[model samples]
Target: APLMEIDPRSPVPKYAQLREILLDWIEESRLGVDDAVPSERELGLTYGLSRMTVRQTLDQLVDEGKLYRVPGKGTFVARPKIEMSLRLASFTEDMRARGFEPGSQDLARRVAPASGHLARVLGVAPGDPIHHLERLRTADGEPMAVERSNIPLALAPELDRHSLAGRSLYRLLEQEYNLLLDSGEQTIEAGLCDATDAKHLGLTAGSAVLLLQRRSYANGTCVELAISTYRADRYQLHSTLDARR
Candidate 1:
């Protein structure tokens, strides 16, 4: 079905009415994430409004995270956010559980000496060998998070030999190194994208994002400390608390 036309006589202002109609189209698939949104002039003309009105409508949507604009390119509909459970799970497993195809692109990976904070987090001696891996994780071909994980090399010796290009780090630890993800302490926070993160996660610099830091334990020992950044518009954390035991 076509979207409802703007009602000139409605109590709502014309810009607000147009904004709602466009948002409804985005929600109902009348306007997909593809580059099909009409030009500002075109949209104004279509709705019998001025270009300023259309611009304001788009600007509001952009701020609300309903849309994103490219510097020289036009704006496009923002992808729907993926609400995920707060339970500990590998990125790959989480995405798969949500019926999305999970993928990872390794940005940087190597074994390095664990320094002050890294050593403390991994519960290892300073200067101990540590496996550092950085990768951009995606769900259904859309970038989701950039995970930077640091693990003590003593726990997973020769781990660098394996090709983790598309594999789950947790799965690899379990199967190859006998490291179990027994428990984890994770925290949630908010931040704006930095230059590096913006490039990897496909967001403009300073875009609002969700920040997560996790310290995972295996067999009563710290196994890894990972920091993950997710697009605020593409991920929502979900958790439940109950007294039943």
Candidate 2:
């Protein structure tokens, strides 16, 4: 349908009709990543819409990650979001499975005394030594997430000696240390990216992000506590629902 086909007599509001038209264009590949969207004035004139309505439609699209704005340039289509399944897999494995080259930049790795909260989470005594590892996770050389992990030193006493660059921690524990990672529990929530994390992710402070906290188990023992912050604009979580569950 043409951009000027918005119907005034139909039950749908003008703004919604315009929104659907734009979405159709995107979904049908009429608009592609980095493709400049029609200017607000152009769209308004073509569709006989007010500037307010056109701007509102564009703003909603931007918030939905269908479009992005450049400071001096106009709005453009955004890259397609990566749909991530809520599966118990390492970031390295997940990205590789998705056809993206996975890489990690070790930001911090040190032995630290477990705090009260960390003690309970990692099944360690308070003040016990634990390995704290922070890394910048990347996909295809693009910053994707920030992962902070805590592992009880008792589980992997020589963890520090291992080379972790672009390696899967889960795989290292399984292959190098002969530990079987059988299960995990993960909780996810929406949050604003902190300045420190945002800088690592190449996003402005307070940008939307997905916070995932996971506890991985080996032989029924909690082995690692990891908190990951993912760029919301580039990733989305997917899950399958079953009535039996």
For model 1, give the RMSD to the true fold: 3.4
The candidate scoring highest on TM-score is 2
Give the Cα lDDT of each candidate: 0.88, 0.91
Q: Tell me each candidate's TM-score.
A: 0.80, 0.96
**RMSD of each candidate relative to the true structure:** 3.4, 1.5
Q: How do the residues 1-245 of candidate 1 rate in per-residue lDDT, one tens digit apiece?
A: 76589888899998999898898888788788854578898998889999999999999998887887876788888766688668878998888998999999989999999898889888899999999999999888889889999999999999989888878999999999999899999988989999999999988899889889999998889999999898898887666768898
lDDT of 2 by residue, 1-245 (tens): 54448898989988888899988889889998899999999999989999899999999999999899997899999998999768788888889999999999999999999999999998889999999999999999999999999999988989999989989998999987777778999998999999999999999999999999999898899999999899999998777778995
